[model samples]
Target: MTPIRIRIGRGGRGRLSARILVSQLAILALTGVIGFALFAFAQRSALDRTYEERAVAIAKTTAADPQIRRAMQDGGGAVVQAVAERIRQSSGASYVVVIDLHGVRHSHPMPQLVGSPVAEPIVARDGQPHVGTDQGATGRSANGRVPLYGPTGELVGEVSVGIPERDVLGELWHELLTFAVYAAIATALGAAAAFLLARRLKRTTFGLELEEIAGLLQDREAMLHGIREGVLAFAPDGRISVVNDEARRLIGLGTALGSTLDEVLPDGRLRRALDGTLTGTDISVLTDEHCLVVNRMPVTLHGRALGAVVTVRDRTELVGLLRELDSVRGLTDALRAQQHEFTNRMHTLAGLLDIGAYDDAYDLAVESAGAGQALTEFVRGRIGNPLMVGLVVAKTTVAAERGVWVELADDSALGADPPQLRLLLTIVGNLLDNAIDAAGDGPPPADGRTVRLALTEDERGTTVRVADTGPGIPPGARESIFEDGWSTRPDRGTARRGLGLALVHRLVSRHGGTITVSEGPGAVFTVRLPAPAVRPKNRFAEALPVGGDRR
Candidate 1:
């Protein structure tokens, strides 16, 4: 493969070639347009000159003829008609007429026009020919015109010569068709040549098997450069090999080539990754701080380890975020626990009252009730099991305090170690919150007002259902409610009310799930999630200290 003329510039090889090709096309198009325009102009000008010369010569001869002048003055219709007919036959004029200075018709190509007046003037020069062109008269065959006057410069009936526009128009049409054929052939040839050139250029310069494969490698390299992961390569001897920009930045080095793993990585997770790759197993090992996830794989050929590659991903910020999320989860659990205790204490007071311990029971009940928001307190306690139970309990307590009853029917078969529980809690919590808010600022839903929640898990996955007995979601508000900032309670305090459902939708989608709303006098939300066929190692448990139990 021969290297083409190499130019040094910011415009690299491929880009420079494209610029050259475009420049060529631009020149070709401009030349073609200018040349075609000039050709049409010249052709039309030549045709017009030839027609004018022929008309002028014929007019000059007819005007100077002696016999024609006497015949026009004394001969009336018979003589003038003969002259007009002779001119029509000889010159191929379509129509001719002769009239005196009074404009009365003396001779006519048609007999009816002999007595009529010549409405048009016999335009000509002194001692020259009247050769003004006009359209042919009456129902003549031709479309063009040429008029002549007599030797006395009197108004001899005009002789109009008509010619069809087809003669010049046909040539122009032919030329246009030819240009189109040329353009089509040029475009097809250019496209085919471009394809062939691109293939040849890629193979010669890049050593790539195919143009598409070269393009793929180019895209992959770009993606690797764009990412923030610190990627490094090893030559199976644990020596530092190829290091990308990100890896160099993380290691704080100018160049990483030819150095051992110990020199480059030092006492960090990068050293552990090099050690892991030497074992020849594809594995992702997390660092002590749980901040980095490193994947090591051996690049081999014929069962021989040619080299190994390690992709270092910084998960420091991600770990911090997960810790924050866990704190939120803890708060949810505490809330559920409080709800359970409240419910038990309330049951004890009711039992005492039923036994007829009037004064004692009444006093005990009033003390226990204590004007505090017990329902709210209780709902916050039961945060485990079928995930929706905790959310439903919280929702019910909130509604009851606000004078609305919430009935929850959940069919979550989630064991204590269900993977989907956390996701379930997020979804149900959002839907119930929306339903409670939609119940309005009024006295909840009249008498039977309630928020209903149900969760069902099956072979497919999990499905959550939440509905409110309030005025139901408005037809128009139903669709927009899931939009990020859409809120039915626009006046509700500084705390955001709308982001809950939007976040719920995003989380569900991230898990490869779908959520939909059912229309009604009240809003109903349903969510479905596809269960992972294979369980993942519990990273939360793994994060615990050596002997610590997350359970």
Candidate 2:
């Protein structure tokens, strides 16, 4: 099937380049016409002036001749006429009329006009050469008059020479033709230059018309600002080039264009994720206040590196919901384990009653009830906060289901609920979960797989410690384990792993606290959180410098 292509703003209209070229050509043509008119007028005036100067020189020379002067002083007869005619022919002038002080013509081109009175008064009567335009029998011409001086140096008559206007017109026409050719050449070159300039402009604009470029700009603005995700673009020199509203809101940035990443964001996992130093897809970073999923991709055009773009998505609420879901899943697993255990005990009791061993069945039921009661009472007594107590109990049940033993240390104690309970829970919950996973990863130890947690609170602050009995973390990977997306185990699926320790570290740092890890046959993670009243004024700022130092 043949397909038809549709073009917008391009039908029944010239392309931008063609339009520009045509407009430039039109301007050049009009300019050339106007320029030629001005050139012709100026050339005519210049030619008039040049012919006048030539006429004056010719008249002065003719008047100075001994023969014409003598003839004019001898009362001017046939001798004067002959001499004037001879000088006129030699000087290439239209006519040379010798006139006396009475303005009577002694010589004329027509013999009949000889010895006739002139129409105008003699202009050179004062013995000064005079030049001007004259309308004579031969039509208009450039005329110059000079007083004739006799041998005694007295003015006798005047020699008037006229150069025909036709000569000036002929030269003007010749020069005009040459100018026209040059003008045409200049116009052609200008048109060619305009065409090349238009092509260059077209290439720079990607052949898009002005209207299309405006439309694209509008569309880009709408899309960039309307999307839910935050968008940030950088130049090749690592300066921020483009940032949208959502980006500013999500990252808490304000008028941050043209700044480098370091100038805007503090040195931490978030900055590293955005700057491509910590490269990954959908990398999760927990800031002091937000949980962000960042993705960075380098941009290139025509094999030229055009810096990079990083997209940020606010995942704070999503992560919170996911955490709740994980908590629910843990509770559900605990319930299933308890149900299975209850079923086995019920079966044992049923079998015992049928075999007439009621005493054994009674003992088994009491032992199961007592063990569960003792663990709960132990956790409730040590943890003063209900949420922390619940978390510990649930994690213990889940750990038991996975064949790992969870033990609360005997010295663990919290007098009352802390001001930052949520942060404390995040810190303790993640550590316990990680410890359980580590403890349950391999074969049970001789003493059985055990994960121990210790909590302490005083006037200073709160402290949490979790230790696992499994293959310990290597010394080289101790610090890396706290990095986002750096997991010791293989990835399970799309579910993001390895954020637990990272989140814990971030919270601890934000609260002006410290977290450390030690290896005592296994990985032991410890965290110390400062009291709210004693927390630093700019905890995040202080923590950034620490992170920068570490990096």
Candidate 3:
């Protein structure tokens, strides 16, 4: 797999990037607005000052001139026109008008105002600088108020000049436009840099996260594949996420991901087992044909549950071997019985021959020989597996003598794959022996204390139920029944050993079956086995070999 690379500036990271960028842009815009206002104010103030100074200079020059005084006194109304004309000829003057002290316009920028009474009077009758009164039509129409004074500083006719408002606003507007253009360029550049930086940071973080996840997945896969036990993991939604190879083979699934347990096993013990396990119930199931032990626990992080992981181990072959061992133990008991019987016969024959009753001794010897032949035939009829048949037959006789009934419920109907069948019988034998031991040496319990065996198979597959009527297993001990060294029988001793049920569990898994023991009128053990949907031509051999190493 190619490793993910951490590239910078591939995609944007967080909202803060845009937010901060916009905030800075807004600040820039606001600053630009404030600066524009200040610049406009300064330009307007300077223009007003220049216009006022020019007007003042022209008025003083005209007033101080003897020619302008002579002209106004002698030339009469023509004096104002001649002064206006000379002022208009001066620099930076657009329009000029002059009025006489008598409140009559003399020279108007518009020729029509030349003969009119000023229409706006500037000087009062006393002519004391008009004593702070507004004089109408004495000043220019466009610019603001202009107060006039004669050469002697007393109020005279007012003179005003009009300055175009556009000059000041035009300069301010030009400066504002330049600022706006610069701000826009700066904003664009800043935004682009922010986006690029955010994208780079985002990509780097995402790449790191992906690398970590990939490593975790690889580790999980190794753990699943390398472990001997089958492992299954699922999400809270009941979707199977991970199934080890061992688990796949055990549950007969080609693939587990994206599939639920219901989809994998359909409606079977494996599915049931998983359901129970996920719900925090640990279960052990055993029957005439199979034994399975399942444990489920929720995977959690910081006290929160992520999902559940189930560990399934098949104990079919293990159970079968344990039962086979029990059968051998039974045979030893039979041999011991036979030795005791033979010793008694030898004593009797010796006693009779010593008493000189030779004919009677001959008849006694024939009777002993006949009894041995019948015992051999009874054992041969009951034992199943060829390798261990002799041992089991002997054991059956021992169980019967102890008041425990050993019954076969048509094991051939189990329909387990041929190799699995062999393993099944062995597991059943152990369960039967355990039940027999629990029954003890007394009249059976009022409930008959009998061990019941039932095996049936059909299109849905095989089910074996071996329930015992002996005092039902203790509730607390039921789940632990298959655990190694969990025997309730103290009398069986180490000679019988506690490996029986543990081995039973091992064999159950070898054949991909489930074992569950429940409380009933007595103890009921149910085993369900689903035939491998894709049965290999050498299914049994492929799964496990006879007398092979078993763990």
Candidate 4:
């Protein structure tokens, strides 16, 4: 498998808080300015419309007065001026003028300007009325004009009332100031909201800049995949959160990073452990040919359970190495025992020779040679495979050390493939060890405290029978004997005492093998390992890909 590489990014990066604060404040202020401007424009339009409409109403009402129309028909005089001035003053109009249909003003704000033609001819056009801004005798004003007619329906005069542009602007400016105050208050409130928002964002980001956050994400990806051990984490609701490449291969999962834990593990025990419903340390589990030791821990923050993280350690190869080590250790001890025994006899022969007993020394030497030859023949005649032979020899000496006798009654030539050889060693080694323990102390201490092994292999595969003469298994206790953490009897201060039988069961079931026991004068266990074709797996296998993609 290819290794993941790490990457470095720029250090001492700036914080994003200041930038965000400035941005938000600017946006809110801009919105306020635009909003106020639109308000002012629309208000000005409405106010001007109101001003024009008011002037038109006043001018039309004054023109419709019977006294004003009668005076206009009598030609310009003081009565006309008096009525026009009174109407203009009371109506808050800038100027109220009476004009003849010929466009000559009959009465005006300035009497001097009376009897003069109006400035805009549209206002004086025959039988026409107009509302607009125009330069009057005094100044530019929004003017509204209305024509008066005699009872005969003939146009005789026109009334013009003006609202000065200066007055209209003054009123608009005052209203705009009030509106601006309200807009300012609203803008201030928005700015306050933006300030709080920026602070919350800064806290959530933990003062990291955008680039720094991106860099951290990249580093997380590299770190998760770079480790050799498997790591898998789940969310509070059981959905898979993080899964590394090694985890996928160890769990035999296929592209399961986002799936729920149950979907990938398919083991209820494992799920319970992940969700904190079950908890244990260094729990052993079997998956295919691999033996995994899982350690699970809850992910918590301030006493709240977030989820769990499970670390998987592959112990398959380690176990095989341990078995090989046991074989080696056993052979070493056997050789040491033989060396000690032979040395004692040689010394006895030497002393006898020193004492001039040639006959006795000769016999002793012959006996020693015979004993060594018998030991060699015994190993070669029963077990042909060197590794298994070493194991049996070691077990024999070990059992002897504990005052129990161990024997390999029969063993066929185990010329099997490497896969079958590993299976053979694991199953037989565990059973033999268990048998020796069950046999307890040897002969005379107990009537028949002996452990025996029988093995035979054919096209259908190998069968093994182990019988021990110690206290045999009790009735109805075989059912759960192979269950994990279920020991026949508890060892002092030890909880996982009977993992051997459990492991044996796993290997047997994995390889389509059958194992059964019977209670008698002694306990006898018979196991039948299926042919190599039934289950073949090389002990030395390479790592799989990120997912379970065989391709």
Candidate 5:
């Protein structure tokens, strides 16, 4: 045999963890790049300011020096250049220049530019210092200017100091390298977090992809509602988790999800069966309008208890058919008994004729015919329904064959057909059958082996009582006698036992009736079915009568 293979569809995208890591890293990288650019711009601006402040401080010191002021007063020449260059070398500035009031440079970084006219006007002639970035002869630098003074505080010229832009850039690069290392670490940590998050999600989803989960959900719903059997899934806490359409129809629970069993079901055998208090397979539970066979199995995954699933199948129609079959079997037994009686009479007649006793043979035949006719007429006169009368006659005949007397009680009176004849028949038939079996078992009763049936009809409803002269029911078993699958009889293996009383109970309860069992010298079962508020059409009225003759 070839092995069956099942396949599940997965998403076309890559694994969840890898995708998360890549996406997170991309986002982190983008954010880091933007951050680094902003940091570099801000750092460069701040470095320029710092260099400009340092240059202003250096120019102020040089302009305040007595020697530089004295030399400028003496008409700036080599002495002034020497003092400026010394300050430049010590302060690490790019250039220092002293120019006279006529906009002529007295000192410059290039020796040839000394004693040459400056390009700009005397900006520091007011004796205030000025600092800013300027493109000088050497390169772009942060420059500062202060007015130089001669002896007696007389303004002679101005001193200018500059710091190169390259120095500021060099410091910024070092800081940026350190910041890049931090950004890399941050990106790595974000990637690790993304991978861990993806792993957690994978475990939560049971390793199924999004597409596979959606597919399984669709399949679950289709199968759940499509099947004929009712399905109910309960959570571990005993609340209804999933209830299909069939389950709602079967149990009369409309939109009962999230409700506990006790909230929906009454305290009865049906509740017991569903709640698992009555534990068994294919347990029969009778409701007000339906007979159900329910099976429950606990669901577990990987040694953990999930809950239970209950499946229900409607057996109402099947049970009715089975009862009808029992009725036919009873009639067949009656016919066989009648045939045996006829054969005995035939043999007797032949013997009488062989001895030439024609008169005795004729009398024997008349007596047998009168006896059968009298029983039929009595049943027909007592019970107005032809169907019920036929059942009584057949059961009496069958009982006689087993040496058990079956009779209608003297007080039995049903002048008109009951409104619910079919239900009445089922109730009476099952009770009489059970009584017959009970009365026939063991030794004959002191009052004789007999099953007695009493029926009464009135405006209120119909009542039936069946009593048997057999071993009385024990007190302990009385309550369970009418329960499904509980039988006192020895297992016969030929047919299923213990359903007759259960079906009877269900029928009685369906019509808002009650049944009780009591014991005196033997067991007595009494059932009362109240009249319906509005009588329904009798569908079985047109059907052929049960227990018809086959021979």
Candidate 6:
């Protein structure tokens, strides 16, 4: 990465980064100010101590001087005053006062004040030395007062030495200049570090402003969940990077972020599609609930592979509706063919009548019309629901087209929620289609090629049993026969070849119904679906056809 420049001000490129830099610099400045104050305070104290030490040394040396001691014993004020003046001038002390044992000043800077009491308070009044800061003849100073004694060690007089407050402050200021220099260096270093940090942030942010980042976040969230399709993203290491709500619902996974794709998708095929080998094109993925057509795209930036994203379009409901349409279309074609055959028969019958063959025409008309009439009459009489009756009639035509014979074994009525009836249509319609395909092509109404559906209703529920003269489900596949994408016949090239049974199983389980399969000579599947709770106005239960066996 190349070095990036950043200006830290109100008009900077990144307001957020600039603000952070300003904050850091402010903190550093405050810290330096505090440190400088403390250093100055300590320097003042140290300078004061140096001044005090100088004062004490001068006082003690003056008191121990033989010449000054003898002069004090001899009461030679001139000699003592000369010695005090010499020490004060040489050591740059504020003042040097020599007081006799009677608390009278012997030597003072002012010659007229000799033989007078010391201007300052006596600190060695108990015949010992004392050191402290106080106001004296010369304004406030660090003073050291020493007791003077003769050769016999008898206290005679005292010598007081002091250094002025101005001298201490002057030295403190000199040391403070050094501290100020150090503080400036420290503040400069801190500002440099802050500037570098801000520059790094600018590069990482792609030089976008704070407002731009917020807008990007909002747009990403809207695109993730606003669309109907499921979206899943995976990092390069195979962990799930992002999963939208639709994806969770479609795959029935919760809180799948940061998990492996395999953990979210138990189906092996679906997991493999999310692998990094994705070539940025769409593929189909079959989960337990959805037949999702997935489009995978490799997520890259600047030609670097980051991960992959997958978009899932749910096709389960659309596929079911298409299957239903195929059944209805087959029924229409069958009805059209039947209509043509009847029309031809009518033309033949009309010719017969014209030729005076009256017996042949009458027989032909009854037989042709009666065939369709009997089938509808039988279906309507057995099933009290007009909707179920129509479905059965259509299913019969479709079964015939496939060369399989379909018949109802028992007359049953339905009393269920309207939504429940729609689900039952799916169940019955899919089962009939599968049975037709399984029975294969054969002459209708023949042995080893028939499909029988029995509908029975009682107080508890409706039971539908479908038995077909086809090969039975094997023992090994009985458990997984209802699972998605589990098809026995792979030759049928359909996108949702085995999804019909899976849909049946899903609807049945949702309604707390059960479906079982048994092997007789062929396959027999029985489904028991319960009726919805009855109300006072309920009218469909226990219904018998008025045209046949109604009371």
lDDT leader? 2
* TM-score computed on alpha carbons, candidate 5: 0.68
Per-residue lDDT tens digits for candidate 2, residues 190-254, read: 99999999989876665788788899999999999899999998988999999999989888898
Off by over 4 Å in 1: 1-390, 410-413, 440-443, 491-494, 539-551
Worst 10 residues of 6 by lDDT: 542-551
Error of 2 at 452 (Å): 3.3
Report each candidate's C-alpha RMSD, comma-separated, in the order given: 25.2, 6.7, 16.0, 8.6, 7.5, 8.4
Instruction: Report the lDDT of model 5 for residue 493.
Output: 30
After superposition, candidate 3 runs with Cα above 4 Å error: 1-212, 277-282, 285-291, 355-360, 375-396, 400-551
Model 2: clashing residue pairs? none
- Give the best candidate by TM-score: 2
Give the per-residue lDDT digits (tens) of candidate 6, residues 312-389: 888866654555555556668888877887789989999999999899989988898799789999887777677878
Model 5, residue pairs in steric clash: none
Q: Residue 394 of model 4: what lDDT?
A: 63
In angstroms, the error of model 1 at 180 is 47
Per-residue CA lDDT of model 5 for 1-551, tens digit only, reads 11123332445434655666677778888998999999999988999888999999999988988888888898876888888889999999999988889988878889898978988889987778888888989999999998888887899988889999899999999999999899889988887887788778765565676677699899999999999999998888999999999889989997689999999987878888888888877787766667789988887655567788889999867765665676667778778878988999889988988998989989987897899899888877778788788778778888888888998977787855578787777667677778888788847966789988998888898889988887768767777877776777654332346777777776677668999999545788889889889777773542322321110
lDDT of each: 0.56, 0.81, 0.58, 0.71, 0.80, 0.73
Error of 1 at 508 (Å): 1.9
TM-score of 2: 0.72
Local error of candidate 5 at 55, Å?
A: 15
Q: Candidate 6 — which residues are off by over 4 angstroms? A: 1-34, 42-104, 107-200, 218-296, 303-328, 380-386, 410-422, 438-449, 457-461, 467-499, 516-524, 530-551
**Comparing 1 and 2 on lDDT, the stronger one:** 2
Per-residue lDDT for 71 in model 1?
69
The parts of candidate 2 lying over 4 Å away from their true place are 1-20, 59-88, 95-136, 142-162, 191-221, 230-244, 247-316, 342-373, 380-382, 409-419, 456-463, 490-494, 509-514, 518-521, 528-551
| Model 3 clash number | 30
Model 5 C-alpha lDDT versus the unseen true structure:
0.80
